[model samples]
Every structure is written in structure tokens, then in C-alpha cells.
Target: MKNKSLYLYSFNQRKGIFLLLLVMIFTQAIYFFWSSNTTPQKDKENHQWLALQSHVDSLKQVKEEFKPTIYPFNPNFISDVKGYRLGMSVEELDRLFAFRKQNKYVNSAKEFQSVTGVSDSLLAVISPYFKFPDWVNQPQKEYVKFENKISDVKPKTKIDINLATQEDLIKVYGIGPALSERILKQREVLGGFASMEQLAFVWGLNPDVIENVNKSFAVVSTSGIKKIKINDLSIKELSKFPYFNYTIAKEIVTYRSMKGDIQNIEDLTKINGFPVEKLKFIALYLEF
Candidate 1:
């Protein structure tokens, strides 16, 4: 009876082990089937998302290509929206409106920039599209003298740009009344131009206009310029100059306080944010 009972126990143990192994194999097959089906579905969905993103990017590129184009218009007639579209700041637009309110017209590109205070780079971009009145485009009539006898012709006297009034400046080919006034205003602010090269610093003077100005005028005498003493002036005072902004003025004052008196242009170059390329021009307004 004991041997029969032991034999039955061994057979039951083997049967249980076989059943567990079969169950494990079935579970692993189901897992493999699920993984294989879901992986392809996930990959397809991922591909669709990538394709959608690419389509969106292509649409954006097309939209960029279809951006609105700009056309020529009179700057004098520019409204707030028009000026905004042209990349003008609020202050610049306000200045234009203010000038226009006085029943004045911006006749030339240079005059437009003078009134608006736009940068040269921006002026270059937009000036090509500026339109003027018919009268401005008309040629002036020149009278020729009929001389009976040959005589020595006196050379035309070159006008001094530093001392030239607005009227004198207007006599130049490209300079109008507004541009003349702007030039005079710039000269007044600088006290005087140290050299003819300093004309390049004038806000709205184009290269061609500058050339005309140089031909007609010379920087024969400098106005009595009040030079700022670098060591003595406060940051506020220094910042008042055209070349020095508040940040650069503060930095200069701090550097001076820390290192003592700035000896020369070389010393100023050591200060952070100093306008190194413009030092020669700026030095005309400053004293060491």
C-alpha cells in the first residue's frame, strides 16, 4: 500500500510541472503577438505625425513667400499705419506728424530722414521708394551770359560749412531748405565740425549729397567748441553729448573713478563700450 501511494504522488507532481510549462508558453506567444501588432501601429502613427509636421513647415514657407510687397509712396502723406509698416518707431512717426502739422513738406529723402530721425541703413532701404511732387522733379532754368570780350574768370569762393547759414546750405544741389536747417542744427549741436569728414556724421546726408556739399563748401574755420573734460564731468553731463549715451557715459565715469584721469584716446579705448572707431570724431568734442 505504501509503494502504490508513493507512485501516485510522483505521477501527480510530473503532471502539475507539465501543465505550468504549457501555460507559460501560451502566455509568451500572446505577448509576442501583441508586441508585433502594436509596434507597427505605433511606427505608422509616428510616421504620420512626422509627415504632418513636414506639411506644416512647408505651409509656413509658402506663407512667408507670399508676404505683402511694398510700393513707392510720398513720405509726407505717410499715416501712422503706413509708417508702422515701413518699420518706423512711434517717436519717429510722431516727429513726422509734428513737422507736417506746421504746413511743411518733406521734399527729399534727406529731408525725410532729418525730420523722422531714421538711421542711415533704414533710410537707404526705404528712400528708393520715396516719391516727391512734380515741382521738385522739374529742372531749374540756368541763364548763360553772352560776353563780347574775353576776360579772366574769377574762381568761385568756397563757402565755409561750419559758418554757412541754412540759406547757404540750400544753395548746394541736393540740399533743400529742410536739409539745410538739419545740417545747421547738427553743426550747432557739435559747436563746429572739426573737418569736412565730420559731415559723414550728419543724420540724413547721403553719400551723393555729401559729395555735393564738399564740392560747394569747406570746413575752413571751426566753431568755438566746448570740450568736455573727461575727468571732471559727471555722467549726466557726459551723456548729453551726441556720441555718448547714458550707459556709455556711466561706464566711462565709473572707469575714470576707478582708474583716474583718462590720458588720451588710447586710455578711453580701454574702457568697455567705448566707441573705438569713432574716437577721433568723438575726441573733437572731449578734452583729456
Candidate 2:
């Protein structure tokens, strides 16, 4: 009986140990299954992160698309900083500045490139944004209207180039605001236009444009001219004239001081660099 009791106890202990192991494995499996299914909070956080990532990516795309907008601007007045931003090199900017320092302007894309020495590639990129003065793009009137009781035929009125305003000049084909301003500036410097041929001297005025200007305008009166008293004027005063540069002015003053007084326009021919060809034009602005 004692031996049988001992055997039963040993068998019970082994069975208990096996049951304990089975229970432990079942609990571990339950924990693993529960952990595998994500919590609502974790799931929500993951969704939020994905949404944030997508939004950031969209913002990056928009930023790329909206970057650096270029606008229409005048290339003539481009500063060093502006030129640099436009891909112009230091040498190119210096060339442009040098041209401008002489009171010259770049009126066209070709002239701009010629002055700046920029590459064709850069010119192609920036030329489209070059906004010239407004008058250049304006369409001129092809015909003039007349109100006459007797005849229906309307004759085009001739404008005086010397008296014409910027608006008036733009009415002529090929004369834009910039060229019109240039014409006025040239006329101011010379005192007045003495002849229709003087139109050829206007900067950036092409042959065809000059032809159109000639057709539309005339020098009707010499009364508006401002003449200089050559004999009494100082070298500085003489140099102020468009025709007489500093060197020529100094020579004329020197000649006057030595020769007493200038008798006539013919006497100026004796001076060096007198611009003999332009004597007639220069004569209009000088007095004895």
C-alpha cells in the first residue's frame, strides 16, 4: 500500500509540471496575439505622421514651382547687383558701364549685347524680359484727317522736328519714346535742328526711321534757336556746346586769345579738329 501511494504522488507531480508548462505557453501566445493588433492611439499617430509627410512633400513641390519670378525691366539702367543676378559677368557689366559713362545708351538687344559682350545664350534668356521705353512699341497713325468744306482730300500735316513733343514724334512710324527723347536731348544740346538732315545724327535712329522722320517733320523756323557768342564765351562755355568738345573748345579759346576775336565761321576752319563738315550746322548755334 505504501509503495503504491509513493508511485501515485510521483505521477501527479509530473502531470502538474506538464499542465504548468502548457498554461505558461498559452498565456505567452495570448500576450503575443494581443500585442500584434495595434492600439487605436498608435494607429492614429501613424496616420498623422503619414499625412504630415505627404503635406510636407506637396509644400516642397509648390516651393520649387513658385521660385524666383523674373519681371520686365530696362536693361539700360541695370545696376551691378541686377546685372549679376541676370548672369552678367563683371567684365560685361564694366563694358556696359563704360558705354553708359560716355552718355550713350543701348537702344536695342543687338546693341545691348555689343556693349555688354554677353554670350548669345544669356542674351536669349534675358532679352525677352528687356522692357524698353513705351514709345518704341506704340503704333503710329498711318493717315491724317482733315475737315474741309470744299475738298474731301486730307493732306498730312508736317510736324516741326524741333518743336515736336515726345507725343508728336511717336506719331511718326519707327519713332518710339526713347528715340523721341534722344532726338529732343540732341536738339537741346545743339540748341536747335538747323536742317532736316540733322535727323541722321540722332542716336539709334536707323536709316529707315530717319526717312520716316524726314517725311513727317521739317525745320520751319530758326527763331527758337539759342546761339552762343563765340568771341566772349570762355573755354568752359564753348566746351558745353555739343559740337565743341573740351579739346576743340580749348583750341578755339586759345586762337581767340591770340587772334583778338573770331571774325566769322570761316575762321574756325583754321583751328584743328573744327569738324569742318559740321561747320554749317555749328554755325547756326554761334554768333560773332
Candidate 3:
């Protein structure tokens, strides 16, 4: 009985306590060993990541040792890698890409800057190497220079595009009854043409046809225009605009409702999908 109890604990009870302690210590030692091995792997990964980050940082800090030879390039066709090589950042490249996707050409360095918003210093460095199509650079300059003598001049009065009849429009090279009708329809919808440039947007009129129309007719007068008041315009009412589609009308209404009245070209330009390029011409046809 004395052996069974040593300070209120029996022999079996002491053995059970000793075994429990040994098990606890054994599990602790095993866990320590496992963690020590796994910790080194985690540390190795962390060290590798830091080393790679350091390498990237060093690369960023270093400047180009030599400038690459820049051949004459059409600024219109600049690719991502080409833009990067030309010192254009991603944002500038993206803007230019968006412009080109609309089938518009950048005719001059000034236009390029307007579209891309590139830095002037960078533009100066790159503009010298820009080569454009002959038509853009000159309209047969050599031919015109060779023959200095002027041809027989016939003074033809330019007709106003807004008031031109179907017969008058048909006199242009490519405008037939169908095209003339379409132009008149467009004029009726928009109240009047703001400029001769609006002829380019007429359906079925190509560049050559537009040029012909411009030579024959012009937007001589802008008076009596049926301009839409856009500040309180409903989506349907705004959608009736020649340029604004249903989607754009909805967005405009949404923008107006949320942000307040669209006061001017600057406010319209801030809209998510408004075409900022044609804002000047667009502003002419809209009533404040």
C-alpha cells in the first residue's frame, strides 16, 4: 500500500504521468525538427525573391549605354516594342493606338502630339525621323513646281452645302441621286452642315468624292441651325443627334444626372466615351 502511493499518487498513476510527459517532449522535438527543415525552404524562397527584386531594381536604375540607330519610320504604324524603343511610355502608346484604330491618320508631328500627348522633348528627338506618305507631305510638289504657268482659271461660285439641291449635289463627281438624298437626309436630321468637312461623314462618299464636294460646295452659313439643348436632354432626344447613338446618349444622360450639366467642350471631353477629337466641330452644332 505504501509503495502504491507516493505523496497521494499510485504506482500506475506515476507511470501514466511519466509517459504523458515523454510523449509531449517527443512531439515537441519532432515538431522543432520539421519546422527547422521547412523554415530553411521558406527562407530560401524569400531570399530568391529579394535577389530577383534587387536585380530588377538595378536594371531600372541603369541608363542605356548607347542609342540604337533609328531609321525613318511612319509614326502612324508604331508598334508596342517600337514605341518603347522610341522612348514612348505605355500611356502615350495606348492613346496613339486608340486613335489609329479609328482609321484616322496622324498627318504631322503636331497632330501626333495632340493624339498621343507625348512630351515635347521626346517628340523633338523623334520627329526628325518621321516619314509620311507623299500625299500627306506634298500634293505632287515636283509636278507643280515644274509647271509654274497657271492654267486657264474659271471662277465658279461655291454653293452652300446646307442649301444645295439634289441637282446641285449630283453635279459633284461621285454624288448621284442616292448619295444626294442621303446627304439631304443627314442635313435634315442635323438641321444644317457646320462645315464642308461634314461631307466626309456622309454615307457612300469616299475621300475623292468628299474632296470633289468640298471644291464645289461649302457651309457658307450657320444661321438658323436647329441646335439641341443638351443640358436637360433625355436619352431619346440626345439619341436623335447625328453623332450620338443610343449608348452614347444614355451615357451622356447618366453623366449629366450624376455630375451636373455638361457646360462646354471640356465637360463633354471628360465623359467616359465621348470623342474628344471632333469636339470643336461637334460643339458648333450643339446649343449650350
Model 1 ranges with Cα > 4 A deviation: 1-72, 75-130, 133-155
Cα displacement (Å) at residue 142, model 2: 8.3
- Positional deviation of 156 in candidate 3, in angstroms? 2.6
Cα deviation at 89, candidate 3, in Å, is 43
> lDDT (CA) for every model shown?
0.84, 0.85, 0.85
lDDT of 3 by residue, 1-288 (tens): 886567588779989999999999999999999999999999999999999999987877674544678999999999999999889999999999999888777879999999999999999999999997643564432334465376886668899888889999987665677888999998887788887777777766768779878888888987747778899689998998878889888999899889988888788887878867667778897877
Residue 117, candidate 2: how far off, in angstroms? 11
Candidate 1 local accuracy as lDDT?
0.84
- C-alpha TM-score for every candidate: 0.51, 0.51, 0.47
Candidate 1 clashing pairs?
Answer: none
Candidate 2, 1-288: lDDT as tens digits:
976775666777979988999999999999887877667668989999999999999999999888476899988899989998889999999999999898777778998998888999999999999987654556555777865777776678898777889998987787777888999998887667998777777777867788888788889877878999999889998898887889999999889888878898889899888899888878878898
Summing lDDT over every window of 10 consecutive residues in candidate 1, give the lowest-scoring window. 133-142
| Colliding residue pairs in candidate 3 | none
lDDT for model 3 comes to 0.85
